[model samples]
Target: MVIDTATTSGDTALKQKVSSLMSTLKSDLCDLVRIRSTAGGATTEAANKVVSLLKEAGVSDATTVKIGSGRAPLVHGTVTGRTGKPTVLLYAHYDVQPAGSWNETEAFTPTEVNGRLRGRGAADDKSGIMMHVGALRAFDKNPPVNLEILIEGEEESGTGSLEEYLAKPENKDRFKADAYVVADTGGIAVGRPALTATLRGIAQADVTVRTLDAPVHSGMYGGPAPDAFMALTRILATLHDDKGDVAVEGLLSKPWTGADHPDETTYRQNAGVRCGVPLIGTGSVAQRLYFKPSINVTGLDGAPPPVHKSLNALQSEATARVSIRLVPGQKPADAVAALRRHIDQHRPWFLPVEVTYAGGGEGFEARTGSTTFAKAQAALQEAYGQAPTTLGQGGSIPLVNLLQARKPDAPVLLWGCEEPAARIHAPGESVHLDELERMTLAQALFLKALSQQ
Candidate 1:
C-alpha cells in the first residue's frame, strides 16, 4: 500500500496511495516471514533481521531484552514524538507455533499465491507485526504521536514473560503510553471486519485419582476393587452437565451480547470439522466460548496400557489435565479454588483425588464508547465498505490487560492482518492481500483520525 507522500490530505486520497504500494508491502513483509521465533533458549537469526528492520524504520530506541532462562528475547522499539500528543504502544508476538512435517511445503519458505501469503508467521503474527511497520512507514516512520512497539517471542509455549518485562522498573517506565494497540486479532472472515473487545481468561489444573497401589489382575479382584481410571473418568464426566455447561460452582456464567456468531457451516469451514458432528451446547457461540467457563480435558496418565498385548489389568493411579476458560469478570485464582473444591466434593466412591493448580490468567473486557473505538470503527467500515462486527476473542494476550492497568486514561484498540480462514496455529497459515491492504488503509486512516483528535 502506498502512503501519500503529502500530508493533511483527504482519507480517500490516502487510501488510493496505500493501495498502490502493494509490491513494497509484500517485499518488506517477506523479510519478517522468513524468521523462526518460537519461545526457547536460542535467538533466531531471522528475528535479528526483524530487529534491523525496526531500526531502519526510525525506531530510535530498539533493543532485545531477555526474559528468564529458556525464554526468547522480547524485541522492543520506542520513538518519542511531540510531547503534547498521546503515546501508543503496539503489542505483537514474533514467535510462532512449531511447524510440523511438510513433504513438499517447507516450514521456513514463505509463499504467495492467489493474493494470499502462506507460511508459519504470515498470519499468526509476523505480518501483523509488519502492519505495525507499514503503518509507521506510511506515516514516515514517525507519526504525530509517541509510540512504543513490543514484539514478543514466547507466545506459543504459553509461558509469557512480556508481562514480566513490562513490569521491570526500567522498561516499565519507558513503556507507558496513553493507548495500546494490540494488532493480534483476526477479521471475522475474509473481508469481514471485526474488533475483539473481550477475551476469556484461562486456568489449568491436574486432577489425579489413586484407588490402588498397583495393577491388580481383573480375574482376582475385578468386581470389588475400585478402578482408578473409571473413577477419574466419572469425576471428569461431572465437569460438564448434559447440556454441556460447566458444572463447577462460583466460576461465573453470563449471557453474551457482543455479536452474532457465524453459523455452523462457517465454523466447520474455518475449523475443518471433518467429522460432521455439530458443535456441543445450545447457547450462543460467544456465550459458550467467551463469557462462560469451559472445562477441557488436556491430558491423561495411567490405567491404560501401552500398545502391547499385555494381560495386566487396570489398578493404580489416574491423572487428567483440566483447563478452564473463565469469563471477563472472574479471577483465575478464584476459579482455580472453586474448581479444586468442586472436584474434591464430587469424587467417586470415596476415592482419594488430588487437584493441583498449573497456570492461569485473568480475562478482559473493554468499553466501546471511547474516542479511539469510534475512530477505529469508522475507519474499518469506511475502508471495507461494510459494517464492523464487534466481538470477543476466545484466547488471552496477557500483556494487553497489564497495559490497561498501567495506562488507564487511554483506550486500547485491537485490529490486525489475520482472518479466520488463515488456518492460524496450523499448517498453511496464510494472509490475504486484500485484507492486508484494507487493514493498511484502516490503520492509516485511524492513525490520522486519532492524530486529529
Candidate 2:
C-alpha cells in the first residue's frame, strides 16, 4: 500500500534540475549502451566510458582496478561534500549479459521508440550506471552527501573482485558509507517506486539417467526396453505436484507480505502463458514468486531434435540441468542436498541417476524499519509521489550478499528504473525515459536526505 504525500519544496527544485539533464542523459545512455560490456566482451572500453562519464559529472579520483587475471576492471570514483555530512556509496555495473538473438531489433543500437530506449543493457544496468551519473549531475557535481561511486565491470559474470577490493586494508575506507545504494534492481512498475528488501539465491545440479549402455531397437524391444529420455522426464515431472508447487521437501516458503502481487491474468499476459493453461503454483503471485523456492529445468542433453529423430531407436543416456532459486533463510548447501534427496526418493521404477552439484550462493534478507530505510522511503515518496513499496526480487545478486556481510552497519538500498516490461537481459530490452528521470531525482533526494542526519 502507498501513502500519498503532497509535493515538497525540495522536490520542486529537483524536478527542474532533472528535467534539464534529460537530453544529455538520453544521449549519454545511448552511447554507453552501444559499448559491448558483456561478460568476456570489451569490458575495457566500457570501463573507460564509465570513468569518462564520472569525470564529466565532477567526480574526483576516478580510476579502474583490475584484480586477478580474466577479471574485468572495476571503475572507482568519488565526490566529496561537507566533512560532517553523511557519505553514500553508489553501486552499479557496466557489464551486461550477452545479447541473445535479436529477432527484429538490433542489439547495442540504442533505438528510441515511443518514450522507451531499446538496446542491450538499456535497463538491467546501463540505465543504472547512468542513474548515478544523472543524479550526480543534478547536484552540480557537489552533492550534499559525500558520494563514493563503484561501477563494476564483471557483475554479470560474478567475478567477486569488488568484494575483494573492499576487504583490503587500504581500500577499507573507500566504501565506508552511512548507506549503500545499488541501482541494479527495479520498481514494481514503470512509474511506481519500490525498494527490494530481499533477494533469492540459487542452487544448481546436473542429473543424468542411463538405462542401458547402448541404444536398443524399439521395433524389437519396444515394450520391454526403457527409454532414458522418458525416465528423465518422469523424474522431472515429479518435481512439481498437480498444483505446480515445488514438491521438494524441506525447502523454505515464507509468504510475501509486501505490495500486492500481480494477479493471475497479469502474470499470464507477461509470461505469455498459453490460453487455458493454468498458472504454476498456488497463492498470491508475490508469495509463490518471492517467498518460495523455485526449480527451473535450464538445459537438456542427449535430447534428439525433431529433424534428427530416429523412431526405431531408444536412447541409452539422458541428462538435465536443474536450477533452484532459494528463498531467504535457506542455505545453498542445504537446498542442494535437499534437492538430491528428493530426486533420489522420487525417481520412477527405482531407476539409478547421477546427481552432480554445482557451486551456489546464499540469499539475502534486509532489515527494515531502520533510519536509512526511512530516509529512502521519504526520498522515493518525494520523487514518485507515493510511499515506496517493500519488495523481494526473484533474482539474486551474489555481490549483494557479500556486501551485506562486509558492511553490516550500513543499510543497502535497491531501487532502479527497470520494470517488468523492460525485458532486461533479453532481446528488445528497453527502459522508459520517464522512469529513469524519476529514479534520478529520487537518488538525488536520497543523498540529500541522508546528509541531513
Choose the strongest candidate by lDDT. Answer: 2
Q: Give, for candidate 2, the lowest lDDT window spanning 10 residues.
A: 1-10
lDDT of 2 by residue, 21-89 (tens): 999999999998888888888899999999999998988789887775545888988877578987788
Number of the predicted model whose TM-score against the real structure is largest = 2
CA lDDT of every candidate? 0.77, 0.84
The 10-residue segment of model 1 with minimum total lDDT is 1-10
The clash count of every prediction, one per candidate, is 5, 0
**Looking at candidate 2, what is the lDDT of residue 284?**
89
lDDT of 2 at 349: 89
TM-score of each: 0.88, 0.90
**Candidate 1 global lDDT:** 0.77
Q: Residue 417: error of model 1 in Å?
A: 2.4
What is the Cα-based TM-score of model 1? 0.88
